[model samples]
Target chain A: MHKDRLVAVAFTLWAVLVTGAFLQANGAYLFGKLLERLGR
Target chain B: MLAFAVTAALILALAGLGRPLAWRLGTCRNGQHLTEAELWALAPLLGALPLAVLVQVVGAWRYDPLSMAVTLAVALLPALAFLRLRPFVPVLPWWPWGWMLAVLVGLMAVSALAPPLDHDSIRYHLTLPRRDLELGRIGLWFGWSIYEFFPPLTALLTRLAYALGGAAAAQMLNVFWVVMAALWAGLLARRLGLGPQGAMAAALLFVSQRVVLNLGAAVTTDIPLAAFIGAFAAVAVAGTEGARRALLLGLLLGAAMATKYQGIVAAVAMMTPLAVLALLRRRGLPALILAGSVALLVLSPILLRNFWITGNPVFPTAHPLFGADNLDIFAPFTQAMAARSVVPGGLAALPWTMFILQDAFDGLQFGFPILLLGLPFAFFRHQGGRALCLVGIVIYTLVWWGAMPHLLRFLQPIFVPLAALAAAGLVEVAVVGRRIGWFRPVFAASVGVAIGIQALFAGSSALYRLPVALGLADIRSALEVPAFQYYGLITPCLWLQDNLRPGERYVAVINDPSVYCPQAPTLHPLGAGEAARFYSRGGLPALSAAQVAEMLRGGNVRYVLVANNPGTDDETYAFAKHRFDAVLLPILRQQKPLVDSASGKIYDALAVLAALESGIGAAEPASGR
Candidate 1:
């Protein structure tokens, strides 16, 4: 149970960081559209 | 409070209006069953709607817009980053424990030496922060501020290393909290049995720009409370065998409750979910044990302390419970509830809309846009996760809407669980990647890249923005600015130990009172006078003018600081001009200018006091205590 839990946690950390990295590389355009609304 | 009203109205409107649009556009869908990673990543933005509404309402009432704006901006920026990342990717690479340990250590190190920019730290948060930095134990009668009388669990642990070793030894306390927060986030993820991807996503959300930048480094009670809340939630999720965990969880929950009053809300929210589950499972004994232990462990001390202090278990808060006369806590609530007949000005409406826009995209300052995504997901049946997340959101939203004192730090406890669910929802959506071929992958990749970029920029901007805004260009320039000096003088607080003689006290009679120059006398209680009181706790009473006049007929205040541009209604100026002319400042000679602004000058008060002490005045006054 403990090992399984650890595995889950380990995977989650990786997924989050990878997701963050992906967002860093490619998600800026969509996010930028959101930011443009701020000019109002 | 008109600001609060329009804000609350707008929030209800936005949530009502936007969720459907977001869903219809498929913006609500992120992936699949939330990984532990995603849960941790997205927990902070739970209270976005309520907070944005509250800020707008507060803004509408004509409170200082800049600080309000700054607070909202700071809090929402992280939410935006997360929201941007939600669609395309939801998780990261899972490192081994060894790698995680090293990374945690590095993050912790960065947290400590980073210049303490959190204003509340020196004022209240770090009165305990600094005290914990020095003495590991929560000392008694810490006269710094009344706010320091919070749950000392976090303070005790943070200061323990410093106290056992030496002063400045526990500079790594911030690092400890950062690591602990990450560790706890991991624990929470594991407890939820999230997949590798889910857990990583959760972890990222937890360490997202919002959590790390805002709560990690700042020595405040918020992170600790959030930590305990997560711990309690984790234990409560451990199932039938976890009945044993109840008492322990109760203790931590109690400690969480003690950290801040909002901890009470979290405790209730967490426990309620557990109780309902136990009931549904027909585990009567475990349910009883859990409920009883929690009440006994948590409520007993709180009730005892409350009764001891204010004759009620909840001595401080009187509204909706037995009414208490403490206006400080309840006044904002009452004022916000009271409807003003006059319409708020047009300028007021401007910020109202701006905060709404900011909060929608930015998560009200921490930048967790994923929160905007998560609320729709709350309608789905993940039972445990959904229930917990909903409870947290409701509590946070209610608190924000009902009583907005306009302090973001107050809302810290609400963020943890909210972030958890938002991350979960994001991951849940990301899991849909298998269905939509090109669309899924494209969306997932774009989101991940977007959030990552936004986080980098947001973090950099947030890190640099305050210092730049405060005009902290250089050491000399910083010191020359009173505001900058206030932030820069953490080390100077330690300097008083070596610089001053044991018996001699320095009194600065500055017309303008500042946080940096706390040894000065003025109407603003938190100024220099409060600092002197903190240093001289239980030792010497620095004589206010009325008190000084009764003793020595007008001598012995030893020093006076006369600052330029000490604005109108400066109590010191009035005293100097009218009442104190005869007794004080007999030899008022100018010294080197302290601040660069037109309103800056340092005066030598010892010489003046010395002359006064030597029979320069006729009034033979009695000595005062």
Candidate 2:
């Protein structure tokens, strides 16, 4: 049970890094578009 | 509205017939059974798609609604007879199902409702068949359709659709394939022993990807090929050994290969597993041979056709074997293709580059963040089935990273397994939630946020042309960014259709000659490819405008529509802009405009006819000759 908990915690942490990077990377494009829309 | 409705009915009927047929062909063995839902999922490629491509091929020399309809009926009737023999199963439950269905129908209705505006579809998928329909045959040898040398799987079906109703009918084929891909996603997740929710999540991830949503409505073979990859994965997970599994896997692989060249990537990915399995069971040699034989047989006709015409099975690739006359033309192209801008930081940065950086070359990227989020969970434990789905994903990803890392569409086939694994991750999150109290809401919040974000991006973009689908508009004026650019270009084609002289043909120097000039037989001529191959072989002399036009005229290529700029099609060759300038500069100046506008110059081919009549027709074409 403890090991499963540990694995889950590791997974959550890993996911956080990936999700953060993805959102940040994806946001560059999204932000550009939002700005374009705003400017329009 | 009526056009959309009628075309929808026609494609649904065709796809309906295909489902039963696919079930009959794919599961015909001892102890082999599949539910209706499963059959529906797999049938598009296994049963119906082959039939569709075959109908177009056999009826190539003489294709029309009457002939094609008869051919389709011949294929569908037999499959319809097998419908009652298959076992039935229901679709997995809601959340995913409801979301998937909504997204699928939304995409279908949008794609079907709008005219086919995908630049590639306009250029070839719809264009090749439209040209063949004009020529009254499959007519690959003569017509320098550039696309004809490649596989005809996507074109043939779209051609059938074009013949039946119009562009809308052909667009529905893409829609049906997208839906099939979604179904396969569910089945692949289920095969991985994910629960119904997990299955739904898998499928949802597939449809949710912004690229899939954008591409779902657009006619392309990437998604269809991806669907086949999923089908192949599901078959691999079936725990079968020996000839049956090999045959099924081969069939799926062949279907993938037929759809796009990327199928070779998929073929290798799936073949590795089969090879390992065969070795373990001591059936390695025979199994490999069977699989190889089937794929070769499927591809043989195309290869043979290519060999027959160009003396090369793949065409333009084996310049040395076939005589290295075209080195200059092909060398740079080969180098340019091989020299893809390495995603900076190589494989380590691939995750961020693929998933995060949305604006890679040509605004193409498909790795949804949720997929990344959920992927780790798929590896938490051994998935269901004797076959390792993870191995297939790893193989496919490695191959993608090795060969073509940056190009998303080429790597799209891996999406099937990737989406399923992501779903498994989500399910794992739920498992973790069950263990840890506070983690439960975190998982739920993540799910809610992930789904919300994906839906917002994918759904909004997909619905851009929904008004056209809803019968509220006439022509596509409100298309999203890239597609909207195509609206003005179709005007010249429409104008040409109305104004052109009978038996007067055209060659589109513009990017997509097919879309612009659908009324008459128009050819893009792929001047860059022609020039490259022509100039590559050193002996080929600088052919004059008269000489070039005369050479093209041998295949009944007459008038050429030289675009002011490259029209809306994806860039096939880097030096495409130089084709007309280098080869036919004088024709642009000397030939009188049949209908010269801002779109491009439509030069009369009668000059070539005149040159021939005057006996100035120079040396024949050395390339596609």
Candidate 3:
């Protein structure tokens, strides 16, 4: 609930969410998944 | 060697001179003192860029040793006097001994000795400056290559190197900037309140990133830009508000801008946070204006030069504004690689794709490991430090994703701050664990282990290449790696340099340009668009190949370095893009090459493209029919 904690949450979500999605498409998952993600 | 020594002295002297300039600005105060390392890291760029521009303004791109020696000899006066006057104690915690173990110093020495083999180095990084040295003045000789117009801060240093010892020496200057960047990284960590060990870890992590490791020996605008931007960020983060602090900020930002256009974006990113803090204190505009003015002081010369030469202020981009027809080469080349940038579903998928899904060798090659794993630490606590670094990373990352995600090295500037923040994160954890009794040893060990791993990664790269970089190994074989691995062949270029007469001019009919500068007068034949339009389309305008060769002869080309480099070298094959070069392939196949490499052939331009009479005849007109 503190302002600092809120700031931390916002930043962490941005880095991890965007970074996590990119990780999967970049060859993290199976080739099929990568292809599927790429197609979408 | 004398020129190099003089240049070193000149850099130190400039640092000495900059101290006063910084003092006079009186911008930073109340906990804004610069570390010894930070000051040293930033000093050379501060000194060299302005002096290099001065030399250029006088139309002296000849880079003659005497000119440099005399100029620097005068510069040494104040520098020595200043050094003698200011004997200060170092405040660093002694934890970065790992630099020696990594043979970091040795890597710099060796790579400097090894020939420059990076793609950009050969193509235009070296070639543009090399041509100017030949002509004895600074001017845009490579009209087809748009890289000529980008800021020349790094290239100015390259000019000095070329003037001193030729291409290899020019490129070797990167070794200096590499060390500067690492030192800045570690010191920046220290400023963020990380311990000496954490600072060292930060520096080690910075060096461990494969691109950073590789780029030191290879000349590109990236490494120097990293050093300058890192230096700028260091000053911005550690120093408090004052006239002097603002001036130092301006100087570093200007130096960064002088190195690459990214400096402008980075300057804005760096200033926004500080300006806000000042505004919160109810006095922001003066600081902002001072910082902006100092940055412009360093940056304006390059812009003036561009405006004079290109008519458009930011050349090729604002072609519509300038109303210059078709001065747009860089934009198209960038657009060609656009698909690789998009995260399929776009921002929604960027995180996963940039890190794990993308090819290991492609953009963001070191993706988000050290950077992302430590993200929570960056954001969690130390609100002041966390916010400073986070704002930069988020802004640059979003911008990078939106516009130019496919190109990886551009991420270097952003990564420096991120890496520092990551180091800060670990340091925080290490500090907290000590107070927690039972968890103390485990946390300490983890921190040590992580730092050790990064140091090992950094060390092994330097040690592996130590011999080659130092010229202990067969440098000739090492230099043979084409700047563009898929396209160029090195042996034929070596053969041309070894066998061709001195002072001869070479027309390289392929993608790589590294070899041409060291050997002879050089010309890269076509721009990126010209290549794509001609080769990817599968044919040249019915103009015969020999006619183009005739054009070369008139331009005084003695030999042509010809390689296939088309569908053979790159993967993005929506189209073929080596038309002018491919046109040379048939001509090469028909000849007994003067010599050959694994992937290329070298032929006497006079003999291969023409015997006496025949050349590519102009296409017959339909009207003739």
User: Which candidate has the highest TM-score of all?
Assistant: 2
Indicate the TM-score of model 1.
Answer: 0.59
Interface RMSD of each: 12.5, 2.1, 8.3
Each candidate's DockQ: 0.03, 0.57, 0.11
Candidate order, TM-score descending:
2, 3, 1
Give the range where candidate 1 chain B is weakest over 10 consecutive residues by summed lDDT: B570-579
> What DockQ does model 2 achieve?
0.57
Best by the DockQ measure = 2
Query: What are the Cα lDDT values of the candidates?
Result: 0.43, 0.64, 0.60
Task: Report the C-alpha lDDT of model 1 over B1-625, residue by residue, as the tens digit.
Answer: 2322323332233233323322232222223223343233223212322333343343334323343445444444434444444454534445642344345344444434433444554344434434433332233322233343444444443333322222122334444444445545555655554555555555555555354555454456676677667655654554423333444455556667755666777776666655666677776456446645664564465466555543435534442253332224344333443332122332244223222233322233544344444334333325565566566556565554445444334555655565556556555555544444444655455455536544554444344433433344432343444454423343332233334443334443333223343332222223333332222214234444444433432333333444433222212211122223333443444333222343243433454444554542433453431
The true-versus-predicted C-alpha distance at residue B603 of model 1, in Å, is 3.7
Q: How badly does each model clash, as a count of residue pairs?
A: 104, 13, 39
What is candidate 2's lDDT per residue for B1-625, written digit by digit as tens?
Answer: 5446544544454556566555555565555555456666665466645665667666665788777776656665644544566555575476645665675566655656576655566656766677667777767632244456776666666666677667776776677777778778888888787877777777878877777777677678888888888888877676445576567667778878887767877778777776777677785567567877888788778778877876667654444566556342245533554464545666777665766664553353564477778777777777554246667766877877775534666668888888888888778778878988877776777677676666566655555556666666554244324534433355456666766666656555654444546533554344333544542444334555655555567646656656555533333332223344455554456667776644445566666456543444334443326
lDDT of 3 by residue, B313-430 (tens): 5653444456424334444556656644445555776654454545532643463355554546654555575587678666766777665536667777766776788777756555
Candidate achieving higher TM-score, 1 or 2: 2
Error of 2 at A26 (Å): 2.9
TM-score of chain A of 3: 0.49
